[model samples]
Target: MGCTGPLAELGGGETVRRAMDVNFLGMLRLVRAVTPSMAERRSGCVVNVGSVVGTAATPWAGVYCASKAAIHAATDALRLELAPFGVHVVKVVPGRVKSGIGRANTAQIAGGHGGKPREWGMYREFTAAIEERARASQGAGATEASALARHVAERVMRPRPPREIVYGSLTALFAVLAASPVWARDAFFARRFGLNRKL
Candidate 1:
């Protein structure tokens, strides 16, 4: 559940709303539906899949990052809330994995406006960078989906699973950035995402 576009665009609000609806509300609905039974039984685990982007906002995918951040925050809250009932809530933050998300996002953008970010106002010069950001997670160094799944499954099946599982490619780097000073983090993202230049 993600979206790619400048935050000031014509349809930006719609994009943000859709991302939140799918990524946050969708997960919340499922959790709500199952938690009552789990609470009554005094057993069960709720694993929420989040992303490294949730920890730190990136340039073009702000809305997508926000959605994942919501998941991460909710997972943390739920962990404490459901602990007394023996329900374990785990936050799975994957950095980057070989998934269909990139393709889906590309298709979504194409379907929305012919995949032409160059035509967008104020962001025209950033077309290439924006396009790259859209597919950034699907790069060559991305971890295999099977590998991530295996690691997560193994840890989760343990006698006591971790409160949060952080795995996949670039997880370490993101962790560092997440802990870095706000100014430094901002500088790093600006340079990395081609936002350092004047438009």
Candidate 2:
């Protein structure tokens, strides 16, 4: 449900559309299928897993960030909408839990280059940075998947589950950045993602 590439590249629109379809629409489809039965029973919980990137935009992974942001916004709306039906909707914003997503994304990006990484014409100089961004979430400091699962399960099982669960590494930092002024946030990310220099 993620893609890594410069938004200015050719065919970027298709990339964004694909990310949205898979990440956002895919969730919507599942929610639609289950919400009806839950509404009828007047009891059920829907847990949506979002990401820290959704809170603050980052370079290279704009499509992924946008899709997650859609999830976050939709989850918020669904919470209020489903409240009347006794169906609880929880938004889980995970920072970086250990997963194979990084490798998978890397492979996808490299698939068109004869099993090697491919760089867009205009972004050739930024290839390494782009690859780094693709693997950023799989760092050693990332949260353990099992731990995140346990925490989420315990909380969701509570009689009164929280409306949102923000967990994992960099979640707090991303939350703060999300609240910061646009200019400041932009400066921080620009420097962090190697966008501070002119190409």
Candidate 3:
């Protein structure tokens, strides 16, 4: 299952919870719905589309990143659980594929659906950064959705699909970030997202 929602400020627990529900729990539900049949048949392939951001949390989109991280972890667990049943689980990590997510996220932010970042207690000055993060995928270098879909389709159809697939723009960047030390990663993201700015 591949899907994504907007980037929103986690002003209260509700926003975070909602993001988790959509990104992580939604995948859980889909898996639950199909696992019984797949188990019975002793054959099936479950493909989960995650994000490179999930590999390492970034400044403005922490909640979204957390949700994707949960997917990665859960996908790993599910792969092991379904192995005995001859089920294959694949995790697709896309960095930034061209899609409507950017527009949707921008609209959500504009509609103040997640929260008013400008009104946030500690994150007020960084709202612009948050907005930028939400819309970052729409940049020129984003991978085409059709291309990503084709690549994933071919991989999943293989006799033994890869447990994890990383593709798209910024995948390499996120890979470097994922391999970096926590302190270094945090510092880089903070500076990039303007969290280090003194307003």
Q: How much does each candidate deviate from the true structure in C-alpha RMSD? A: 1.9, 1.7, 3.3
Tens digits of per-residue lDDT, candidate 3, 23-89, equal: 8999999999999999999999999988998998776676778789999999999999999999999
User: Where in model 1 is the C-alpha error above 4 Å?
Assistant: 10-12, 112-118
Backbone clash total for model 2 is 0
Instruction: Give the whole-model CA lDDT for all candidates, comma-separated.
Output: 0.88, 0.90, 0.81
lDDT of 1 by residue, 1-199 (tens): 7688777773556667888999999999999999999999999989999999999999988889988999999999999999999998899999999998898777666665555433568888887788888899999899999999999999888868899999999999999999999999999999998999875
* Pairs in steric clash, model 3: none
* Strongest candidate by lDDT: 2
Residue-pair clashes, model 1 = 0
Q: Which residue runs does candidate 2 get wrong by more than 4 Å?
A: 10-15, 112-117
Task: Give the clash count for each candidate.
Answer: 0, 0, 0
TM-score of 2: 0.94
Worst 10 residues of 3 by lDDT: 1-10
Each candidate's TM vs. the true structure? 0.93, 0.94, 0.88
Q: Using alpha carbons, what is the TM-score of model 1? A: 0.93
